[model samples]
Target: MSIPTLRMTEDLLVAILLGDSTIQKKSAKHELKFYLPPNKQKILKMYIEKYKLQSLICIEGVNVETDFFIVSNSLVLERIIREWSDGTSVIFLDPRLLKNSTYMLWLCLFGRKVNNQVIIKQNTLTLDTKHTLIYFFEKTMRTSFLRLNAEGHLKVQAIDELLLASIIDNRPSYESLALHELLTDHSKKSFLQKQEKMKEEMREYACF
Candidate 1:
C-alpha cells in the first residue's frame, strides 16, 4: 500500500510534544490537563525543522494545545499503518523496548490526546475504515495499548506507550551523550536507565 504524499507545511505543523503529561494530582473532582512550556515552544519548532516532521501534533489533552483548531485535511491515519507495514520510517528496536509500536510522534499523539479535551469539533481522518483516534490507539495500533482491566469503564481507560518515549529522539551518534543527558527525567530513574540503554545501543548502532 502506498502512503499518500506527505508534504511538510505550516498547515501540518500541528502540536508540540511537551513530555509526560501524567496527571499526578487529583485535587478534587476535576482532572486538570498539562500545558506545554513556552520555553519548549521554540525548541519544539526547532525539533520539527531538525527532524523534518512538520505534521507533528501535541496529543496530550481536545482542541489543539492553545485551543487553536485548524479545520483542514489531516493525514489519513491508516496510511501510516500501511506505510509501516511497507517499511517506511519504521524503526526497529529491541522488542522489549518497543513492541508493535511505531514511534512516529503524530501517530502517538493523534491516537491518544486531542488537545484540551474540550471537544471543539469531532475531526477525524478518513481511514480505510472509520476509526476514532482513541479506538485506533487502543485496538488497531500496538505502540499505544489500553490497560488490561479497563474494559468495563472504557472512558476512563489508561493507555500505555509501552516503549520509552525517549527512543523517539533519533539523532545521529555524536549527539547520543547530549540527548542521553538532556532527555533524562529525574523523577523516573527507570526512564533515565532506558535512555542509558538506548545511548549504549545507539553507540554500536545496535539499536540505530
Candidate 2:
C-alpha cells in the first residue's frame, strides 16, 4: 500500500499549521484546503510536534525542490493568497470539537481583536473568518464532511463520492503509487451500518 503526498511552500505550511488556510469550496481539493488555527504551541514545541508527526514528514532542503508525501490519514492546509499578504488564513475543524464552547468563544474574541473581515466559505461563501461562532460552527458541518469523507469516515460515501470525485479532479496531485493504494481499500460495512454508527457519534457530539 502507498500514501498521497504534498509539496507546498513553507509559508503555506504555516497557514496550514494555523488552520487559517482557504480555497474555493467548489474545488474537490477543498478537503486539503480547510481552516484551523494554532494558538498554544511555541515554535520549538510546534517543531517537535511536526518533526515527530506520525502522519507528516518534514525533510531537509536539498538542491532540488522538495515534495511532501501525504496519504488518507493527512491533509495539506489550503492557501488562497500570499502568506505575507496579511494575517488571513483558514482550516477545517472537527464538528465534535464545537461542543467545547471555549474554543468557539476564543475564535470570536480573536476575530474582534483582528478587527478585520472573517469569513467561512461554507457559511459566508467568501474568503474570511471574522464571524460569529455559531456561523463557523455551522460551517464546520459542510467543510468537515468533505474532510471526513476523504479520511475514510464510514458514513461518508467512499468509492462513489468524495474519494472518487477526488480521483478525477485531483489525479495529477496524487502519484501513481499513492493512487493505487487508495483504489484498493475495501470496507466491509454496509452504508446503513455506517449511518447507524455515525448517528451514535452524532448523539455524543450533540450533547455539547
lDDT of 1 by residue, 134-186 (tens): 44445534443332122211121212123354346453332222223222233
lDDT of 2 by residue, 1-208 (tens): 1321232222224323323223332233332233322321222234334434434533221222222212122243323222222323333333333432222222221221111212212321223332333354445433222221222211111322223323334532222222222221232233335546668888999999
Quote each prediction's TM-score.
Answer: 0.30, 0.22
* C-alpha lDDT of candidate 1 relative to the true structure: 0.31
| Candidate 2 lDDT trough over 10 residues, lowest sum | 108-117
| Model 2 lDDT on a 0 to 1 scale | 0.30
Question: Each candidate's root-mean-square deviation in Å?
Answer: 13.5, 17.6
State the C-alpha lDDT per candidate: 0.31, 0.30
